[model samples]
Target chain A: MLKLRQGQAAIALVCVVLGFMLAVQFRTAQDIRSSIPFQRIEDLSQRLSQTEKERDVLLKQVYELRQTTGAESATKESENIKMGAGVVAVRGTGLSITIDDSKRLSKPGENPNLYLIHDEDMLKVINELWAAGAEAISINGQRLIATSEVRCAGPTLSVNNTRYSPPYEILVIGEPQTLENSLKMRGGVIETLQFWGIQVSLKKQDIVDVPAYKGAFRFEYAKPIKDGGK
Target chain B: MALPLVGLIIGISLGVFFPLTIPVEYAKFMSVALLASLDSVFGGLRAGAEEKFDNTVFITGFFTNALMAAGLVYIGEGLGIDLYYVALLAFGLRIFQNLAIIRRYFLRK
Candidate 1:
């Protein structure tokens, strides 16, 4: 009884504060309930716009690439492009290269074959020239296409299924300096071929002629899948 | 007890009608402090029932306990730990114990 008499005022004051807290908490909870749905809608709309912006950027990139090649808008131009794909003769500023047998005779008891350029050697040169941004390449007079074949035939080399004896003249149409530098860079294809004692020469020209690919193309198994846009 | 009940009713009505704008960040602090305050009120009730309540102790404990609980929550938030759970569990347990003692006081045989 004495304790209650002394503590009554403080106890009432403390209870009032507690009750006030409870009421505020109740109102805050109600506010949270109303705000949650709005937050979710805001988040979803933000995601949708972000995805839409990404799609717009990709579509713009596709449009820019198509404009450069003129590949998508007109079918006749695209067909002409397909016809000219490593064929139908194209002329541009480029480099002319000649790779021949080594000046030295074959080593004692070593195969005479090792001193001559093989199909793989020619293939390596073609691949390197292409890597150096060569737009068109031909070995001797035979133009190289996607289906062109290079192989050994007795003492001669077969290109586009036609055999020709070297000194091989490879004509390439592209940025001549870049192509020449790519070859002349130490530890590259030209260096390796030179180390084998093979003779190699490169000349830049303002106008280089590459004959049309005369070989036939055969597609046996592959076909492009149709797109809805087409 | 009658005076406390009357004061609580008036406080609750004032809270409901006053429309005070407490910031969202302070909500966790307020909640933890409120839990500590609730524990103190229940403790006071239990102590009064047992004839051992002290005015000065109850008043000081009211403010100090609430502040300490809120400070603990703020520190825990800064340290990236959920230390409010410690205050919550401690106060929650004490409130229940006080309620049980207060109930026993009323139901004593």
Candidate 2:
């Protein structure tokens, strides 16, 4: 009985050791990796820039109401209504990228062969979306944050701990023309993915509303470790 | 297992006597194995002797590895030695520790 107890204790100890070592290693490594500009600052700056954009639809509506209403008593009332509705949160328009497995569109040396999306590919799209100045972005309804990490587990891509499969629809609500052009412009992501035989497409929508970040933005016990310079 | 133990001893000796001769890169990688093994063997011993392994000890072991790595880097900067080289020294020590565990406890299984 004593010997058996000792054996079990040894196994438990190994688990604890492995878990502790790996957790610390991962935490510190992630810190150093994120501190680099390519990871943290760039994404934050992009999100900030997107948030600060304000479209003065109210101003335009007021101008039109004034010209049409003429010198009427209700003209002021009409202007007020226009102003209220005009400030109704301006949303951007753009193409939504739906990445999925091309199980049906199989060819020579191409995508969907594994019937899955790789983490690197997801990273590419995320990076491109930021570059395109996407106002708001989400993947399958999960709002992305600065610390969000896309990691691969077997065939699935785990975003912030939630596993997602192919046909990963990335919705970006931004200026229709600018967003579409950004995705399809020369030397752009579409072309790069095209080479890999991955499907690339774009479509203009009347209104593309990308939702605000929904997940908790809680970060515990981690802060920037000095400026560290670029 | 014996060869790894011998390597660990050599690493410790070189670090103590002709520290400058040892390449920092090699030492850093070696440290990972050493530290990992030390973590494992001690873990097993604790389990064998004590009814349960202490969480505090395991956490501290991890913290020690991290501090050593970071401290070594800072020290290297001050001494005009490559920070990476200092990391290698820690790694070398870890390798020795790991070898000791593997030869005594791990291989016996």
Q: What TM-score does chain B get in every candidate?
A: 0.95, 0.41
B11-102 per-residue lDDT for model 2 (tens digits): 44443443232123233433453354454454444444444545566455545765566566555644656675555555566556644654
How high is the lDDT of residue A55 in model 1?
Answer: 100
lDDT tens digits by residue: candidate 2, A1-230: 12323444334434444444444444445444454465346557656765655335556656777777456737666655543333222356666777765443443353444434577767877787777666566677655655667888777777767888766777776666667655654335665566445665566777766554445645588766688845
- TM for every model, in the order presented, reads 0.45, 0.36
Model 1 regions lying over 4 Å from their true place: A1-72, A75-80, A222-230, B1-109
Query: Worst lDDT window (10 residues) for model 2 chain A?
Result: A82-91
lDDT of 1 by residue, A1-230 (tens): 22244466677888788888888987876765665576467547755875897799889867777767564546655656864576678889999999998875665566777778888888888887886668889989888887788898987999888889889999999888878876865346776787566899999999999988876767789676778547
Q: Which candidate is the best by TM-score?
A: 1
Q: Best candidate per DockQ, number?
A: 1
CAPRI tier for the interface of model 1: incorrect
